[model samples]
Target: MFKFLGYLFLMGYILIPASMAQNHVFVEAESFDNKGGWVIDQQSFAVMQSSYLMAHGMGEPVSDASTTVQFPKAGTYQMWVRTKDWAPYPKGPGQFQMSIDGKPLPTVYGASGNDEWKWYKGERITVKQLQVKLAIQDLTGFNGRCDAILFTESTDFTPPNTLDELTAFRKKQLKLSDQPMEAGHFDLVVVGGGIAGTTAAISGSRLGLKVALIQNRPVLGGNNSSEVRVHLMGDIDKNHYPKLGRIVRELDNGDPGNGNPNAKEYGDARKIAIVKAEKNISLFLNTHVYRLEKQQDIITAVIGRDIATNQEIRFTGSFFSDCTGDGTLGYLAGADFRMGRESQAETGESLASTKADDFTLGTSNLWASTPRDSVSTFPRLPWALQFSDEYHIDEPQSDWQWETGFGNYNTITQAEQIRDHNLRAIYGNWSYLKNNKAEKYAKHKLAWVAYIGGKRESRRILGDHILNQMDVQEGKFYKDGTVTATWTIDLHFPDKKNSQYFEGQEFFAGTKHIRVAPYTIPYRCLYSRNIQNLFMAGRNISTTHVAFGSTRVMRTCGMMGEVVGMAAYVAKKHNTTPRGVYQDYLSDLLVLVKDEPTPQP
Candidate 1:
């Protein structure tokens, strides 16, 4: 029977073929009917710009992932899979093979190739039946990955190697849309669903503006989400926007510690329900904004792709918010932004270096372990980086300070390298503790390890006024002061002990806490100087490296969101841009801010 299998299911952005060719098939690993023990990993999308299916066996071989495919023609076809050799060296730990109709392939892939993505070819075979089973069998289960598979009768055809070229190829082959589908028209569109973004959407919607909240992940709260598990820091309901932060308080996670074992502490379910209940707001999750459309200096629309469905949605809004911690939306819109540290000569920051440098705070893939009644055994890792006694993490639990990638790599561009480095550090440490000193870790088993690493700093989108360390130190109060940042100027650097052992490869970090009284951040630092209609909240807001230490906390970012939400309404009412909210309609916005709560219509 000729049937349209998973491949035929069309998303809004994916173009339906004019006609089906029975001999050629392209299967996305993530779209497999049955994933078995294989898990879908999208974290490296920042680096690889694509998602894949991985056999995360944790040092053990996992079950096979299988799918039923119905072939229209019983003819000879060549097979090829897009994957990476994680270990890259010969006879690496991670290895897997492809099976067709119960017959395993002769060659084992993903073990002895380079780290770069390439097509691993397989044998040409004649289909004996109209329907056959395709399976990916894991050999080692140590994180062998598969992005996609191609079965074609064309003997001379080869897939593109680079990301850009491959994207063009896929667009041509799949017949994808030249333009994205219209998602919706909104008074305000917030590009991130963190506390800052969630509150921004709620505030705007309650004030009678149609809002759209786009989140790349499945849940709200960004870094504070259960996946990352960082508790909300800094203060709310204090200073200028006393009444402004009621919304943030409504959705705050009450988790006392960073790596809470109780799943309920993350508040993922509660946030989804609350956002779903709001009538004026439209929330789109699992949608990543990768591109933007701008007319002159004003942002006209943003283009986002749904990771699961591969459907692209073009959101049109009068005003847009870049709350994505990476400042993704702003960067796409060509907003002026700064990455890395500025020199003391440039910003006159006391803590800054004599010269500018490309060093930013590191990222932490926080993890936790629980003590079980029975002793649990973890696999010994020979492929991981070795840690000396001085640098070894002796405990089973690792928190926020277990950070990496500061001077080692770029947190934004080289994200995969950073993630892999962090993973190696974690696995290497755990393996050493479990293997060498078994008795110490006998009762503890790994409970949770965040694959979605919690990032600290990336791009800081420059606004009309860039808040600096001097501003926080002197407590400079601007006439347009909106959000009160209360956290100390807490900066992080590589721990001296760890640095001594690992040198430039240190994974652990130590904080340099400089206490400061709460200070007001002006409205001028909330919107882009060049991008007229762009508004910003969260860690991406206009602040120098030193000043960001205080404003980067979740609560302060949430309050910034609250202010942006109020200002969005004023922008819509007065028919102006984000700058206009600070210039012409400051009084109207301040009225909304000072009041306890604006009555929801």
Candidate 2:
């Protein structure tokens, strides 16, 4: 028996390495020690000698570096890590990277562990050849190490033989599909069109790329477009949030990103100005990305379905980013995400419920009108789902009846139906004058149902950290934080009519005063927990629902877009990923935003 145990232990160290996709062993160094490559985090390093796993420290270096590894074979694989620190050193919980033969592995971070040398193992790593090099780094600047490894053989894993492989890997990891996208072989692909997408694509194109923007709408400005009909709302670079929404400034009438425009009836001339300014970025309007295509975890292409043409398209890129307000691209692509409110118990907000989930406040199709010559008698909405006599208004000038079909059907589809419904509702509501038989209801016709609808109240992409109301109320300042949200938790509850669509028993959305100053939005919220090379913007960033309600505002979302854009730029410059910016290259990101608040709008 003793001899058998010895043989097994020796086999653990000597058996030929399998070509599996797993991170059993990781590098403990930053740069490549040999072969111009480094291995980072796999799974857990089996704590053979202790009860706990190895750990790294913040601002502390683990210098016991080993790069050259005697591997038996090679293949595609992902590194899994069970790492932690003594109360995440204010800055973070870093990651362990794996680089083999000059190829780097996607380092997944945001794990919690303790002081013991716990056992961690890598997923099945796929190896193709023998004897490759590896290196690792403490991404959070924390002190830690990797131990055990699985090193199994994997089939789904695609080996990174070339840069095309890298791009393909990233695209697959980001959930970008096989469909062709407008941005082909571009240096950068800005995912969301709305204002951010447009600006980012233009900016990146200017910086040089076949910049392509994947906008889900026929036109741009997403919620502010003629499709949704919701008015443009938000203030630019004011005192509190401090007008940092540069995208708004450059567009939106060049108003410095702070003007509150009720309507851009001038055919979004300002928006058109910005769009026409860029000759580089090809706008893929009416395009929707369903999946990501890539090898390993790096993004390569965004698979999309064009609404107008109803054709599948693929947009490949050197670097891909998401600016979609709902973050649909990132979510379907295997990015880490979260939803709903963090109960008051979790986030310590007075309005938060006690439970947590992936729920969020929905969009609103707003209507704008001025007082007409006379009052139009409203029809008795007999077929109206929530219409009632008690709901009748006497001197109704501005009515918020958008609560009609909310939560009735799918939200993604709701935009299409409700947009038309709102118009019909307006005309039909006005038609009540002919039916009500009241003189007060004279010849007042419908004005407008807004050009866009307010979409996505609280969609949070689960990141390394969840920005909660407490973080805002407490004015939490984080060294690892990249952006900030300055709005209040403005949630809207379901009307008393239909309770089915309501996410929680308690609905929230009402904040008039800006009680809190600027709250730091963490860096972790920008990327995914599982897939690497993916970045997020808009309301889908990781945050409590209540916090999301506040940050989901247009101006704030735009800032998030700019931050992610700048971060991507930084990552590209550094030849790393989004997570890389938060770890070792944070200063580079902050330097971009360090300028004075310059909202040109």
Candidate 3:
């Protein structure tokens, strides 16, 4: 048959036969056209569902990555890899080692095994050359990771070890593209470029819509960006959205200290020059999304991926918004959320916990330190986490409670073991303040830390109003109010002396706050009751969990992303859905949340 369809289209295979398949090959370690210094970590796409390539090298040993692979029907394969032994001790401090057309193998592979992401294997090569290379050496510059490289030549095939069957066996053995790559059509997509998705993509591109603004971190301030430095707390222009936070004061990085190394204050090129000066916005940035496509209850698109060209784009929208803060494209479009703490008789809230629980709150990784004029050495971590002395904390910085996972963990399936237990509580409290507070941090050092985990709670989604804590302590005035929230219920916890030294795993943190009286919020707690067009501003809106401690700050989630980008520009000028802008365009979402006259001219 035309020479077996030209050797199955030159071995990239379609339905087998490049001399009959050979079971698996896969590859993709950032398609390594020489990824030497490694480091592509697309922050655990909802927990190791993709984007990897690590070898971080923080403790030093880097530069090796390599890549090339080709072989179609070679002889003895077996490889394996996928990685993550990230400190499973017995000898695991993120080790590495592998190579192939460049020799070196003796199975070093990551290091024992404990942080829960398997695969490993190795050795058994013999390809008889059809293009080879491979590489990836790193023996502890600390991070390690890898995520992809299968090989196999049937020793019972193997592969698929869950994460939805290894993301559908890497989308059908890396043939990928189940139709994605579009990334355009908009009208208002806005999936987290944070400050409540870049003020809902600059208020749905100044009410004209056609937005997009994805942002899987390249910065646009989710956790006030400067890579999670957080600082843009409450109050902004006042309730019922007074010109809804004037696009969050045109992207404020105004620096109020949250990881300041002599304060450059996260301007992030003035929020990417105000979302590239919004000509009907488009943004994207590192992309991410994961997948979505719904129909019965809306959602229609959302694919993403591009963590440095892993391609797959697909956006499409006519009003979407999940401002990701873990609502992750509204939990991949099945929506209907709510996680942790609810029952004081089911959200009469008053500091909940009379039943419903999973505890919520507790993420921060924040750090900073400076002083250097001389002496600075630090490096005796022994795979961290061992603090003593009444739970030591001699801080040089980090105010956001250097937090860790939380009571029952599972912050989106234990976000990389809660950002590696806040990097082993900031390198075991800066190596116990450089071996017992060297004359009060002698020369300080450790400049900045946030390995991005500023998160504060997850999944709220369920909307059409969930707002609780007695509707912000009885202020309640709904008419679809739309963001004012101010911050006071605060929350957090796990710091009873670091929860008596890591019991249930604590990493500092403590807060209760309570204060009150600022209110407003509503727009039915920002869209989606059954995913009928998602929407939702930061801290995953729809509140509860003590009204997401006063609508989880970031300028009250940037005025609920300027009232869901003015109700997704009145749901694309009335084709409708975000609860049809409060049931048939409630006075055009109250004149786009009274950006001018909710009263007082």
Candidate 4:
């Protein structure tokens, strides 16, 4: 990960303790099928490291997951294990325990699930040179993947004095810290780690801003994750926006290689790998930002908490960007923003509410099932439509899915209903498979459901100009446009029956009979109305509900991030606020964004 020539003499520079003989070993283990030595389906995998960690379930969940790994030579040895959260509910972080000589360590749970491939460290402990054992546990109370077991001692180690060399050496290290022991004070702070947040962090850091990407969870790619489990429906083509995420393209394990054929899990592993390699990005994976300190519209410092340690920490940034889907930081910083639908009289949106509805479409917990693939019946919700094989597919090879939206209720209450609706949708499909005798898939069960909630609507930061559907329909182009949306004015309502209750028009499903072409979205929607020197991106951008529905798509959102990042860079260069770039230098901003060869993004 170091720059060119940064690796020279790096290996010998920082000498770390290693085994007396300086020996190394490799081991390979699969899910709990210890049939002979570590093997998958009885086939051996070439060992790359000295650990044959097992998932312990043949990739299935074991009723009791505690397993013991005998330590070879226990002199303050460090052990590494990886596992997936295979639970009915999505996996939260879990814990692992160490038992030496049948006695548990002082701590009940040793390490949580946050330590996946990115999680590494060295141990500082004194152990009698005797064989010992470690018992690992999943405190997260979920069942999933666990493997890549590694064990090593002080004698077998190396250190690098140079930052580049140190980063290179950290690839396999595993350890943990509780409080704000890690460094703080970043040059730029990205307040969300979703797609926009992730890109902003990486891009900003690559631009030489010591950036701290504050994400809610361990992984990046907000909606497109095992947690949210939503397929990214954005433009992957460069014709739309300059290929800002080619790195992401390289990382994606496309449809050809996904574990679940039914689940379209395409990921930009390249981008992820790059982000992980960035030294400037101090990724606080399992951390959340709490509050902020602002002086006259400028964020002086921000406060946050490491979820595990419950420790309060403060960080300061000369420049900050709000990528939080909810725009949490912008709202707190007294940013002027609008949420829900603005009245038609306000933004001139066709579907704008006469009276704004505070209740947005809300987030949904998504579920995906293959055509003909069904499982045992789940109890159907009262509102779920009954299946009579009414919906049909003529093509035999086409694999399709149904995404049913749980209508808005109380945000919290409707969330449960939405989840239940997803479950019901799964069961209803399953019922059709078994009882209805669908010949294609009578064997497929509920394949996967999103662990994190799939959000459709939330608080939108009120920007200087709340882009509306009318403007989009009229093709209100801005030379300084930051986002371009071609998708139609697609909207969804609760049910046909509840349509009248809504202040705005209902969302039509499937039919974009009047699908709109790509229109340039304005730059005003990227900053707050109330605060100065603040920027906003992603689904939370200031737009009337009707306009937001179309612009909220990830592709457009990604473009929004890229444009915003370029604008930020311009602002940084000019030493002005985001609006400053949008205004006086807008023509220049567009030229900068389009002309600058995208960083090795």
* Whole-model lDDT values for every prediction: 0.81, 0.51, 0.74, 0.52
User: How would the candidate models be sorted by lDDT, starting from the highest?
Assistant: 1, 3, 4, 2
- Model 1 lDDT-worst window of ten: 1-10
* Model 1: how far residue 249 lies from native, Å: 1.0
The digit string of per-residue lDDT tens for model 2 on 308-396 reads 22244677776777777656666666666654556677777776776764444554545433447765544333322222243322332
Can you write out model 3's per-residue Cα lDDT over 1-601, one digit (the tens) per residue?
A: 3245224333432221111134677776755666687777677776766777777555566799776676775688888887877666455677878888788888887777566777877777889877777788887677777777778777766677777888776767655567855756787788878788888778778766778788876677877777677788888855655666877887875756776654348787788887887777778677788877877888778888766445566877777888888888877778788888778876565578889878788788787878878988777776778776666887788888777766557777777778877887687778888887789886887776666677888778878788888778888787777677767888877878677767787877788687888878778778878877778888887777877877888888877887787787777777878887788888877876675322111
- Compare candidates 1 and 2 on TM-score and give the better one: 1
Show pairs that collide, candidate 3.
187-210, 221-225, 343-346
lDDT of 2 at 363: 49
TM-score for each predicted model, relative to the true structure: 0.93, 0.60, 0.38, 0.62
Model 4's TM-score against the true structure: 0.62
lDDT against true structure, model 4: 0.52
Q: Alpha carbon lDDT of residue 444, candidate 2? A: 48
Worst 10 residues of 4 by lDDT: 41-50
Which is better, 1 or 4, measured by TM-score?
1
lDDT score for candidate 1 against the true structure: 0.81
Off by over 4 Å in 2: 1-183, 202-210, 229-235, 238-243, 253-263, 344-350, 357-359, 369-382, 386-388, 393-401, 404-434, 450-453, 495-514, 596-601
All candidates: CA RMSD in angstroms? 3.6, 22.5, 18.6, 12.4
Model 1, stretches more than 4 Å misplaced?
Answer: 1-23, 60-63, 70-72, 89-91
| Native-structure RMSD, model 3 | 18.6
lDDT tens digits, residue span 439-478, model 1: 7888887776676778999999999899999999889999
Candidate 1: lDDT of 178? 63
- Candidate 3 whole-model C-alpha lDDT, 0 to 1: 0.74
Looking at model 1, the pairs that clash are none
